[model samples]
Target chain A: MEKVMAFTGDEIAAEAMRQINPDVLAAYPITPQTETVQKFSEFVAEGRVSTDMIRVESEHSAMSACVGAAAAGARAMTATSANGLALMWEIIYIAASYRLPIVMPVVNRALSGPINIHCDHSDSMGARDSGWIQLYSENCQEVYDNLIQALPIGEDRNVLLPVMVCFDGFIISHGTEGVAVLEDKVARNFIGEFKNIHSLLDIDNPVTYGPLDLFDYYFEHKRQQVEAMEKAPEVVKKVGKQFGELTGRFYGLLEDYHLQDADLVVIAAGSTAGTVKATVDELREEGVRAGLLKIRTFRPFPQKEIIQKLSKAKAVAVMDRSASFGAIGGPIFLEVRSALFEEQKKPLVISYIYGLGGRDTGINQIKQVYHDLAKAAQSGKVSQLVNYLGVRE
Target chain B: MKLKGWKDIPWGGLILEAGNAQKYETGGWRTFRPIWHEDKCKQCLFCWIYCPDGSVIVEDKKVKGFYYEHCKGCGICAQECPFEAITMEEESKFRKDQGGRP
Candidate 1:
């Protein structure tokens, strides 16, 4: 084990980029996400890594340039947040649909109508259908770790899909936390070199990419993207286990804590999961049967792992940082409901949307959620599909 | 590993159909057909200079036109023509025979 000084979340993410040392790193900065690129630029300027760090005009061109670079068989990376990510929406879909295998870090934030530079899952959740493999981080360590793990999982021979490693904007992205820095040689060996099977601009092969496929072939391409996304969980687990062996930190599809002996559990992803874990500790100290299931990977949804982990719990409180707007409930809760609906004894799953626009989510709100879960278990009924925490009307 | 006749196939294992070269016959449509109104002709070749896709061709003192098989109908020449001598009339009769713009 290598010991280094405690580093901030942004510094750890930058070190991972330094280790990966992608051939192409293109980005236009938005708040919270700017630090990753800044440190990356410093690394490039100092000759620590030989990377083409493109200072693109907008997030659109940043992603567009990355798409071209990846198609040219270069190991590519980029970063953005909130509106920056929203601006890259079109090309993000293009990168995934074409299976370009680019890696991106999204400092997750709320999409603006009122303009917020705060933590939320809105940016990443809005891009769910874009076919990118999405991984959410619960802490600074996970942010550093997920970027290292995302490389091979994304660029796997069978997968060949783009990946987005999301950490909460301002909450995790800007918030400083202690993280153990791994050796460059170790990280490089862990991720290995990128091998592009089908690059667009390979002159020696001279194959045309992103052609007008019309209906006859477009559906098959989309179907293949779906199939590739399905293949990611196994790849993620395989890569995660390999990482654990190398670093002694185990990551899985869904990380369960104190759930084995508890009857009520709270589910959350991103930075808020840390608060939920803290809340679980308090609940257990009070002799309440409460636990937490922190989701690490959102796409490839981790349906089976979620079902198995929550099957024994009497009730579940799903905390979502983003709203699905209509129909059933919160995005995470809707997925959880669908996963549990077919089980013989389904728990009373309730959805709660909290911590929107960087509103500070303390242990009290999490404690309140656990209280609701316990009440639901006692009453044997779910009061509502979705509830907003900390909102006064 | 050297499979004959498969070298030209695109990846995702697409089988290139035969007679793909004839698809290049649309090269005839690359140039624009300028209608010369000998009465309204100021003979300014600004249309030839400003065309980005280079659809116009100027020869000698007289402006001889060609068929715009690949003309995309951008009408840049029509926009740039100083004399209003060039009109972007579609190949109505030929298009009527070939369904639409070939």
Candidate 2:
């Protein structure tokens, strides 16, 4: 009952845009993300999808245009990469504070200093606490599938925050993989139509969109934001269930591969998670009780689920493609530690920074992480809380 | 314990009647003013460099003056002075000629 086609992840994203058929498409061109906008531009050229693609000057304007469009009661989609995301950071917070359900596909890449155009999670990591729901994709399939899932999760009545789908740049964005795209009618029916509960463009009912709140009411508004975020897990679970029913593919806040009855576990996110799973499979063949915990949603962090999963393991290795300088560990590591703090028996969690600056992290390094985790579990003490897995110097 | 007359209320015990008024004071506030000690001032221009609102003025390797009208009282110039020359003080006592509203 589904239409299947052999498509790459980028093509899948482009076709997903066609299927979703947003009213406004605003994004700037950046590496590893250029293909998506190109394909979308072609879609606009061919008259297949009727939407207004605004070519903005900068990523800030791209997000500003998206805020305007979303406030105008339109379903909008945008694509960006590392530096572009950094430029749009201010407006990204504004979008979330305004509670606009704008969906953005972030081609995850390393933030620049020396300059690298490779896959990493640093871009999304820097924007972690910006009040948007972040969803990480492990493969080309999830990249396509999660984009479809993000709409329902974000547009739910209770949780009306923006959603960002992050896929590893060049790895999943550029790498070719087989993907199945459902028909436009099917996706449209699945995601339904955009109903604006509060729109800025409605002249019949006069209302204010975003007004400055004084000190007396500021805390209550922020508390309301937290309340909306706390309510997102229910929407995420419901949308995951509906997407599974429709697409026959299941998604969770955290997807486990052989995590049950495992002595050691390696937690990862983004495309590198696939490598971790592959290495886990090989280690299992050799009688190593190693498992993989692929994190899907990072924000509105599934803290309860993570605490339950990792509390039972002997040792856990958290692999982050980003760094939090001067902290005890990375951002994900900090959250995981806090989540497991209330539990009686907490696993020895060590944060490992890898795949930074676009360096490819193969299965060998993942095996090394597992080996180090096993050693630490055996000794019952962490030699290093944060380990740089493979670095030139 | 059960008296229910209007004069028995707590607020009704006051000596003044309801429409009676008393004089009010409106001179409790004052704006900040920056003063530079000429003896300790070396004219290093650090105050000019550090002022957030560009309220300080330095000319010809000497302290010329500063504009206190638009100063936000952020204390950046006073904190950043190398010689601790700038000190903040209340502008002056309120007077009718000094534009007191009341």
Candidate 3:
């Protein structure tokens, strides 16, 4: 019923796109993300899919065209990384405000200033508040699976907002892994056809989009967007459960590995979660109670769940791959710390900024993090609340 | 129609029709009204071409009259008239002069 084959993350994303066969795809090439569109373009050339691939001149125009296509009652999709996502910033907000269910696969890379094209969370984290549902993948298998599930979650009548599927730039985007390719018919049947509630092309109904709204109604429309986001978590869970029925793989807002009865835990996201899992296994064999909490959904942040999971731990360390310049801790660290504030039994939490600009985060560095967590647990206090792991002091 | 609250307003507050703007009688906003003169009129149609609100009524290649319902009385037609055929007058004075028919 399913075929198992080795494929890169980019190829898996392309395969998902071919299976979805969206009505429109408008994208530009950026490192690590280029292969995704490149492979999709071959699908277009060879007549494997009927998607109208628009080779736009810039990322801004690519997102603009996606908004237009989605407004015109078509299922639109795109892919980008780093600066490409930065260039589409204005239209990104516009797309979400218009409430178009456009899906985008963002190959995560460091935002440029010092000009780095390496794996990091800066790009998507920069857009955390832009009213789009964000799903992070830990490996190639999850990347493919997330992209397929993104459709129903975003296109749901109650949650008509844009969705972004994020994976590490080079680590997961280029890394090859064995993936179970779902049958095209099964994917299609599960996703179903996109039906727009309000379409620009609906001649009889005649509606308008993206009009000027002053103080009288602007706040209400924004509140409506908020309500849609509030409704997303349930829709995402429902869709994930249904997808699990088809593929036998279940997903949740966060994945807990060896967390029960563990005294020290590490919270991380993306491909780094795999390394953390391996290190957790080793720590457990050595009789150390090290655990991991892997974040899967970042946008509609699982705040309550995060607090519940980390509240009883002796000490918690949040590993962030991106920096927040002047902030005391990184983005995820800030969120985790804030969430824990509501809990009476708050654990001693520390922030670790690591693997920025595509620096390798080996198992040794991860073991060091566990060692730090163990020390923090014993001391019941952290000497350095904010730390830079695997970086030159 | 009376708008009760923001919730009653459609999303984005978008107007659905192409020229449905005519539904709003902008004539109420008129401070100065345009008065057309037919005596020294050349009917060159420049006024019709330059009217921003599309309030200049034209039919069969001839200027019919101002569609006052949608006109904001911007005086664009009066400014664009070549033969001094139209003039801007205070709405109060014009209403008194024409007995409120002009």
The numbered model that scores best in DockQ is: 3
The full ranking of all candidates by lDDT, starting with the best, is 3, 2, 1
Instruction: Sort every candidate by TM-score, greatest first.
Output: 3, 1, 2
Question: Once superposed on the true structure, which residue ranges of model 2 sit more than 4 Å away at CA?
Answer: B1-102
- For candidate 3, the TM-score of chain A alone versus the native chain A is 0.99
TM-score of each: 0.83, 0.80, 0.90
What are the runs in model 1 whose C-alpha is more than 4 Å off? B1-102
Cand. 3 TM to true fold: 0.90
**Candidate 1 TM-score versus the reference:** 0.83
Candidate 2 pairs with clashing backbones? none
Give the clashing residue pairs of candidate 3, or none: none
Winner by lDDT between candidate 3 and candidate 1:
3
Native contacts retained by candidate 2: 0.00
Q: Write the per-residue lDDT of candidate 2 for residues A1-393, one digit (tens) a residue.
A: 676666656777888888888999998999989999999999999999999999999999999999889877899889999999999999998888777889999999888877988888889999998989999998788888999989989988788889999998888888887786777778889889997656667666444555544453455556666877899988888889888888888777889999998889998999888999899999999999999888899988999899888867999999989988888778888888888888899889999989897888999999999999899999999988889988877
* Model 1 per-residue lDDT at B54: 51
Residue runs of model 3 more than 4 Å from their true location after superposition: B1-9, B12-49, B55-75, B85-102
Q: State the lDDT of candidate 3 residue by residue for A1-393, as single tens digits.
A: 779889888999999999999999999999989999999999999999999999999999999999999988999999999999999999999999888989999999999879998999999999998999999999999998999999999999889889999999989999999998889998888889998867899988787788666665688878878888888989988999998888899987889999998899999999999999999989889999989999998888888889888867999989999999999999999999988886778889999999998999988999898898889889887989999998897
Alpha-carbon lDDT, every model: 0.82, 0.82, 0.89
A342 Cα displacement, candidate 1 (Å): 1.8
